[model samples]
Target: MDVNGRVWLIEANPKPGRTLFIKTGERKVYRTSVRRPLQYAMF
Candidate 1:
């Protein structure tokens, strides 16, 4: 899901997809790849 978990929580489906019995807003970001990183954005 995106940064806002509140959104896209449910879709318009009468059959019902995967039921979300529980949801925790706890999230953590981490980098698992090693590469040259630049701290600047090219415009």
Candidate 2:
């Protein structure tokens, strides 16, 4: 964000860390994160 409070996305990761959610006990999110792309590709 800048002084005017406007947010900007500078970069993105295609393959992000997958274990963080599991370490934080967010199993559902971890599963969805792993599954959604496969589902989309299948369709």
lDDT of each: 0.29, 0.86
Candidate number of the best TM-score:
2
Candidate 1 local Cα displacement, residue 26, angstroms: 36
TM agreement with the true structure for every prediction? 0.14, 0.59
Measured by TM-score, how close is model 1 to the native structure? 0.14
Worst 10 residues of 1 by lDDT: 27-36
Q: Where does model 1 exceed 4 Å of error?
A: 4-6, 16-43
Q: What is the lDDT of residue 25 in candidate 1?
A: 25
Superposition TM-score, candidate 2 onto the true structure: 0.59
Clashes of 1: 0
- Tell me the tens digit of each residue's lDDT in model 2 across 1-43: 7899897877767666888899999999999998997898588
Error of 1 at 28 (Å): 38
**Tens digits of per-residue lDDT for model 1 on 1-43?**
5676553545445343122222232222112111112222121
Report clash pairs, candidate 1. Answer: none
